[model samples]
Target: MSNEYLYIKVDKNSMAKNKVVYLEDIAKLYSTDTDKINILKKQVVLTIKDNKPIKCVFSILKIIEIIHSIYPDVQVINLGESDFIIQYQPKKERQILKYLKIVMVSLIIFFGSAFAIMTFNEDASVEEVFKKIYELIMGSEKEGGTILEISYSIGIPIGIIVFYNHFSKVKLSNDPTPLKVQMRVYEEELDKTLIANASREDKIIDVD
Candidate 1:
């Protein structure tokens, strides 16, 4: 390879679908030398052991050193994060386990939300309020089944749909749901925490 510069753009976080990770898996190459780029793409970068999922942080400094050692004449330019994380996970997970987890989480959410709503209603004396409203409008005492109670029951779910901006697979708008936004924030924080802890855990890949 002639003495030339190669530009690589990498994100702060990347996913490796399999145990083995390559240069192409984490970084985008920008160079005129297709052959050299191909060679670099095939280079072994990281491998997960025991067929287990893992996340590891790596510094681009060591990567640059490695590239320079291989092609001393070629300069490597970094156009992305100085350090990044590669999360290794298998593409195919156990279907039964996956479904089981989903079911379990769904059940928990259902029960938990039901409990919260019930507790709130009890605290606010919703039954007494409904009875008074019923008496005031109908000029009589309210029994168990009334339009007020029915409407309140229906309105709870509708309010949830409007507040959450989601129901089943349907979306009320283009904006992401509150749950999705929170999950994304959680994932971003997790990635940052993992990257920050890598060096302390002696799991950071860097120049020796």
Candidate 2:
């Protein structure tokens, strides 16, 4: 085994049969450049203890804790695993920053969209248009909102909320939301880019 790679078998059957499973076998599946296998040989054990079989399950946090104790630079990736691959992750601390960045981006999108709509309404003189329509309907100068203005004011937001499917949280029509579809496309592209970059970097390291 190499320090660059560690294999762990997440035995669902073993977990079901035996309430407690030692990490010894998982630890033996990898060795460092120094040919040491005892590094994590007796380090950790996963135990459901007295928990019911149906409710008891493997904990990712415990597995990660065991792995991190042995290999700080590596991360476990489940590969539809009888055995799982451990890959190099450059900066573990950066995971927190990644989540923070997502939250910031979400806030920006929410507020920025609201601001953009307001700016567009102002630029297009939407209020003036509504006022004119109100006067035409009432057959006099517009003092307050007419029936058209009231109906439109209520209808526009409702239309937007329904069209986006956010009000009911279910699609009324067959079509998926443009935003959700675009997000999926972006996620796929990002995954491809990351994989390509990782492969390129590995090749470069191999050449060196």
- Give me the runs in candidate 1 sitting further than 4 Å from their true place: 1-4
> What tens-digit string does per-residue lDDT give for candidate 2 at 77-163?
433222222222222458889899989998998898779978988999988988887677767787765776678668878888777
List the RMSD of every prediction in angstroms.
Answer: 2.6, 13.9
Pairs of colliding residues, candidate 2: none
Give the TM-score (vs. native) of candidate 2: 0.43
Score candidate 2 by lDDT: 0.55
For each candidate, what is the lDDT?
Answer: 0.86, 0.55
TM-score of each prediction: 0.86, 0.43
